[model samples]
Target: MHIRDPIHGAIEITPGERRLIDSRAMQRLRHIKQLGFAELAFPGATHSRYAHALGAMAVATRVFDAALREAPLAPAERGRMRQAVRVAVLFHDLGHPPLSHTTELALPPLGALALPEWLVDDPGRQASHEDMTLKLILDSELASVLERSLSDCALTATDLASLLTGRTPPSGAPFVAGGVDYGPVLRQIVSSELDADRMDYLLRDSLFTGVNYGKFDLDWIVQNLCHVVREESAWLALQRRAIFAFEDFLLSRYHMFMSVYFHRTSIGYEAMLRRWFEESSDAYRLPADPQAYLGCDDVELWSALRGSASEWARRIVERRAYKVVYEEHPKDPHQAPAVESALRAAGLPVIVRRSKGEVSKYFGARRGIFVRTERDVVPVESYTPLFERYAEAAVLVRIYVPPEVREEARTVVARVLS
Candidate 1:
């Protein structure tokens, strides 16, 4: 099947890829916005994970093709690796809730719907879209396609898990920690720092959000991804791959964060969504449990909000839609309470949420991005300097209050600025 994507242009897929894309679960992405509530601000930021995933898989295919030319894979191994990569791209967004990451912080009546309950609370516990992704695929249409098209059962349940999480399988191959070994060449293509996922999203997001900062030289980046064989200690390592577009990818991510993801008003709108769901009774019909939230996508969430047994959901989703009342930077953390006090006194219901490391007191509480490095993929913090910079940067704190309190917020901001 061929798709003419607005961001990546023409997208081609095999029959198996088409089946996976057409799956009921994968189709759920249409309602799950890539930048949830972002369109409320940008108007054009309504792209969905479905599009991004297609673009990502396309990039993966191109990268794998190029890398194989450099060091071709055996026929058997190449087929397995391709299937794994396709599965990985298809299921990457399976766990994301309706609004994508916009609803990431809101606790479902049952923790996260994506991973098992253990992974949500225990950050160290092996929690990933990859793990959940594999589970979805092995149990879904992707599994059927793998059996039908390739006729190779190499993509075992465990192999799917390993591909998504970047873990090396046991016994058969002495897979080094954090290094992928799906043959030498294809692994390099799919798992590198400057891999398909980043390449697709940067350009795709730029087009969707109407932001130009993420645009870069794509063909150049792909062409430059050559093998970097290095000898360390006694052994010669064949797995070293150049981070051809890594810096560009990192910089593009940073720009996307600043320009689109973290826009203050966008943050405020997301905060409103969070408040409506958490404080409103209508959004939560079930007890706080993972099973309740599991498989509940955007449509269900919105449906619950509109017809929730709780009064809060009815009011926000039904009547007001919860408008933003106040927004401003915290010149001094000490004054946050004062701002909160003034807004409350003025008759608006107020809630404040901060980014990690924004306050010295919450130092160790912040979760940094984890990367699968040559050494480790556990904490993305250790491998990349870019993520560390993001962690330390002062995150924006959004305060959401009832619209009736808008006058009070304006009064408080005027006083603070004066």
Candidate 2:
């Protein structure tokens, strides 16, 4: 099956992948918007997760093909590794609930989700969309498809799940029970800082939103990717010549966050959605069971919101989103309370949300993105000053108010901040 994607052009799906995509769980993604409420701001951003999964799979194939040329693997091992990476990227987002991250924020705290025992210690790192994706792949009908399709390649659902979750096997240890050691490089392709997921989403989101901020030299970066043994483990590295392309990719991500992802209007609608979820009665509760959760999608959520009596829901349904009274990057932590007090004193309903600039933090501190130079491999940060500068910046803060009270709220915020 060939899919003509707006961002990636023609993406070919194998018969096995087509079967998986035809499954009910995968088809549900068609109704779940990639950007959730972002469409409220970028009208063109109504693309679905289904498209992204295909794009990521296609990009992963291209990247893995490039890296395979330099990898020291037998033909059979190379073929198995290629299939594993493809399956991992294709189903990585299967577990995302309706509206993507917006609903994730509304879900119960980490403790409430059914997390594996290993992740219990770090409450902050508990069950997430990745966890959900792993669960679905392991327990759903898709698992049957993967096991049957990959039987010839000697890969299993667990292998695909681990790859999709980016699980790093212990250094110098074989990844599979039989001593196969393709985990590190495959995981990096699926989940690293410059993985196929980010590469696809950056271009895909930019194309759908009608914005040029996220555009980058994808071909240059992909063609230059090389797999190498680093610290006793295989890691994805870039040819030194592609350093400029890598920098451009990072800047493209940062600019996209500022211009599209964190646009004031988009944030305002997301805030309204969260408020609706919090204030609504129990009738709209999300399912805790992984299987039940699969039944939820954007259409279901929109119907519930449209039928609700909550003012927040009404505002969202009518597109009467709240106005951004004030928004600033590098938020002042100490001054927030004063601004809130001033807004309240002026009789304005206020909501303040702090959105961390994750693209910077993820690439800056992740310790990935190595540059393979003539002398030796080095972390990109060692040579790029921009990484450190952006990593240290504070999270962005946006102050919101009802459209009618926006002017008053803005005045109060300015007076208090001054």
Candidate 3:
């Protein structure tokens, strides 16, 4: 299938991917916003997960080609690596809840329940999507297509193993399999600090949000990639690691958090969505999951907010969101009290308090995976004055002004920030 994406022109996906994209599960990604409430602030930032996935796959393919050129792999291995890279990128966030991560964190219990029933009760489970993805690939018709794409019958087994372990197919294996890690060489392309996923998203998000800060010289950086032996393993390295390219990527993420993703006005919009979701199952009484109200792509969690019988969803859909009553940037990274105080002062409802510590937990909050070596702890801030300038910055506070007092509340916000 030829998908003409605004960001990446023509993205040619295989028939198997086309079928997967057409599935109700994958199609739901169309309704899920790539930037969540970001479109409320940057009107153009309404791209969906469908687009991000396709774009990421395209980028991954390019990175795969680069890896092959730098250190050639067997034709059979390269074909399998392509399947693994494409599948991994395509389904990376298939389990993201409605409103993406925002609602995922906000509606934990419902979010918890909304996950496939199979995953909800299992303590031994990985991510719901990861499990479902493997299940779908192995049991569904996708299995044969993916195998055919790789020309290997055991691709699914190898792919599953790779995601489970960060290692790729053994050199003795006839082919590599798709997962977060396929082969060490392919893993470097998909992961690594400077990989295709970030490269694509930075540009893709910037383009969708009307920001230029996220773009780097992707062509130049890709060209500079070279293979180097690090600790007896071959790894891809960039000539300069394109410090400027990386600086742009990091700065873009930072600014997007400030100006786009966390815009105070949008916070008000999301709070409205949160309230709507809260009333989803209670006798406050709703007929449907709000997830139905959004476009087809955004379907990980039912947008119970959009389907709420409550006045909240109606108000928000009608653009009657809250205003920002107060704003603050905490000076210390660990200042929980400051966040609590600001929320109290604004008189906004509490949802979740995400500490840096909480944010650090990944792969379903089991524990963080760290790669330890003799190298110095990455002083990310030390590398660039830009990062150093914001090192002490901890938290950003936004007090959502209920729709009723927006104008008056705007004044309060100005004074509080001042």
Candidate 4:
């Protein structure tokens, strides 16, 4: 199947891949929007996760093929490695909750997933969307399909799961060849800070949102990808010359978070959705069963909201979302309380959301992508000043109020800001 994506042009899917894509688990992504409430802010940002999945797979394939050129892997292992990364990236977002990360607050406890000890160490904590994806791949019918598709390469769902989860693959098999482990580098292509997801999403989100903040030199970055070995484990590395493009990619994601992802309108709606999910927890619960998850898309969630009687649900379903009365920057003080207090005193309902945008969570401990110079290899963070400049996570604190009381909320905000 040839998928014509606006971001990657033509994305080709093989017969084996088609079976996975056609599975009910994958089709659920079609009803789930990529940006969630972001569509309310950017009208054009109504793309589905299904589209993003295909785009990420396409990007990962290119990265693997390019970086593999520098790796010394046996011919037999090369095909398996390539297929593993492709499957890993393609299903990475399969477990995302309805409306992306918003409704994750409504998920069951980690123990509910029944994941193996090797996969998740803490089953007592709240489950994440990724946990759901992992179960879907490991235990659901999708797992059967995944295993059968990978039968040719002798790869099981657990092996592919290991690639995404960064765990041991059926006996700590690290794609070893001649005593060198190439698993790290291969997994990094689908994940890591410079993975295929970021590569495609930056450009895809930018195009769909009608913003240039997420646009980066992807072609240049991909062409300059160089594989390197660190402590005997292969790692993803960038050519010294393409370091500028890598910096731009980091900045692009940062800018998108501030300008698009963290837009106040979407934040306000998300806050309301969170409230509704909490209030209606018993009435609308997320199932632990993977097969039941096929019906748990945004459509079902929206329908529940539309049919509910709760004030939060009514506002979200009626498109009468709360308006952002004030925003606090990363360096600003915490004044959301004062505004929210004054609004409550004035008989107003308010939602205070603190959205944290990390500059690069992966670059903090010198474990990020490597900058391969002609002489030596260093952590990308140490190689670029951009990391230090963006070291502090960008914080956006927003105070939201009903549209009818927006003016009154602004009055409260002005007093708080003063």
Candidate 5:
């Protein structure tokens, strides 16, 4: 099947892949907006995770083809690795809750989900959408469908799940070509700081949100893919020439968070949603059952909010989100706390949220990735100061108050600013 994505253009999928995309878990993404409440701020930012996954898969294919253009791996092994990386990227967000991260608080403890022992880190920790996704693919009926769909590729759901988890398969690595363990490189393509997921979303979200902050030269970066062998394992690497383009990709995501992802209006509604979940905990709880979880999406959450009496829920349903009284950029002198306190003293409902962004946290590029220079292979951090420059997480603190107290809140903010 050919899908003409706005961001990636023509994305082609095999018949089995099409069937999997049409599965219950995949279809659920179609109803869940990628930016959630951000759509309320950027009317055009109503893309879906379904589309993002397909785009990421397509990206993985492109990155794989380019990265291995002259590698020593045989064609058959390359084919397997490509499918593994592509599908792994395709399923990475299978577990995101409706409205994206807005309702993750409603998820049960990690132990509650029937996941494989190898998949769980700490059962006591609250479950995330990623955990839910792991459960669906490993233990749920989706596993059967996944196996059936990929029978031709001879890859099991376990193989794909291991790729997502970044773990070795039961007995050995998933891909072995000429004594090289190719599993780590495959996992990196799906995850690492420069993974296809980030590659797809930055462009997808930027286009849908009508912002240029997230735009970067993805083709240039992918075209420069290279791998370095360390201790018998192949790790994802970049050619020395495209280091600047890679930095631009990191900047694109960072800028998007500063400008679009953390827009006060969107953050206020997301905070309000969290407040509603806190105040009305019994009103909604995400199911641990993978099948039941499929029923949880943005539409269902919105419906629950519409029928609830919680003040926060009412605000969200009525499109009366709290107003941002003050915002503190990551490096700006702190001011949100004082404004937040004064708003509360004035008998106003307050929501304080801190949106965090970082450039190179995900794959531990400092240790895992190497930049292959003409003379030698060196750690990415040492190759450039970009890592140290963006090591500090950008924290955007937005303080909001009930819209009814807009004037009162503005007065407090003005006094504080003055």
Candidate 6:
């Protein structure tokens, strides 16, 4: 099957992948918006998770092929690893609920969700969409479909699930049937800092939102990829010449987060959605079971919004969102509290939101990306000053208030700032 994606052009799916895409769980992604409530701000940003999944798969294939060119593996093992990478990236976002991460904040704590043993290791961590995706792949009908589709390659649902999590499989693990282990290189193709997931989403989100901030030299980066084995561990590395392209990619991500993902309007609506969900969670509880949770989507939320009596839901439905009274890039972190106090003292209802602007934390760690130098492989940050400068910068601190009180709130905030 060939899908004409706006971001990746024509994406050709293999017979196995076509079958997996046709499954009920895959089809469900068609209704889930990739950017959650961002459409409220950017109407063109209504693309679905289904499209993003296909794009991720396409990019993963490109990176996998590039890595295989330098990887040492038998022909049969190469074919198996290729199929595993494809399957892992294709279904990585299958478990995302309706509205994506917007509603994820309202999901019950990890303890409340009846997650499988493999996913329960981090009890203190909350149950996220990734956790949900892992559960569906292992415990739902999607698991059976994956197992059957990749049976010839000796790949099981567990194998694909493990790859999606980007973790190394244990020696003699149950998932490693026939003693075949694709190793960390295959997992990195889908989940690493510069993996297919980030590559596709940056371009895809930029295209749908009509923004050029997320654009980067994807072809240059992909073409320059090489696999390196150092000290018995494998990693995906890029040619030293592509350092500029790699730096551009990181800068593009940071710009997109500032201009699109964390746009004041998008943040306001997301906060509103969280408020609505919290107020209505009792009447509309998120399912603890993976299968039941699969049934929940944007449609369910729309239904509740249309029929609900909650003020928060009604406000969203009517587009009566809170207004931003004051926004600034704080020079001193300690001033935020004083600003909030001044606003309250002036008789204004205020909610102060601070956003950290460190884009490198997601992409600049020691294990994140590597440059294949003539002498040896080195971490990208070791030779790049851009990474260190913007590694952890505070971006915005905005105070929100009801629309009716916005004018008064602004005056109070101005006084605090002065």
TM per model?
0.73, 0.90, 0.70, 0.96, 0.95, 0.93
Each prediction's RMSD over C-alphas, in Å, is 6.6, 3.0, 6.7, 1.7, 1.7, 2.5
Candidate 6 off by > 4 Å? 111-116, 168-182, 280-283, 330-335, 362-366
- List pairs with backbone clashes in candidate 1: 109-288, 109-289, 110-289, 110-290, 281-310, 282-310, 370-380, 371-380, 372-377
lDDT head-to-head 4 vs 6, winner: 4
How many residue pairs clash per model?
9, 0, 16, 0, 0, 0
Of 2 and 4, the candidate ahead on TM-score is 4
User: Which lDDT tens digits does candidate 6 get at residues 1-418?
Assistant: 7989887889998788888999888888998999987888889999999999999999999999997686667777778888888888988898787788877765666766665556577766667888778777877877888877888888877677678775544433422323443466677798876889889999999999999998999999999998766555567788999999988988898888888888888788777777776667534456657778777888987887778788777877888888887677746446667777887888877666777766566544446567888998887778778866776686688878889888887777778777
The TM-score, computed over Cα atoms with residue i paired to residue i, of candidate 2 is 0.90
Candidate 5 lDDT over 282-389, as tens digits, reads: 467898988889899988988888888888788888898888778888778887777777778878877788888877675354446779898999877788888788
The residue pairs found clashing in candidate 5 are none
CA lDDT for candidate 2: 0.78
Candidate 4: where is the Cα deviation over 4 Å?
281-283, 331-334
Rank ordering of all candidates by lDDT, starting from the highest: 4, 5, 6, 2, 1, 3
Candidate 3 lDDT over residue span 211-259, tens digit each: 8767667776666555544333444444444556655655666665666
lDDT of 6: 0.79
Query: Local distance difference test, per candidate?
Result: 0.57, 0.78, 0.55, 0.85, 0.84, 0.79
Of the two candidates 1 and 3, the one with more favorable TM-score, higher being better, is 1
lDDT computed for candidate 5? 0.84
Top-down TM-score ranking: 4, 5, 6, 2, 1, 3
Worst 10 residues of 4 by lDDT: 276-285
For model 1, what is the error of residue 355's alpha carbon versus the real structure, in angstroms, after optimal superposition? 4.2
- Higher-lDDT candidate among 1 and 3? 1
Residue 54 of model 2 has an lDDT of 90
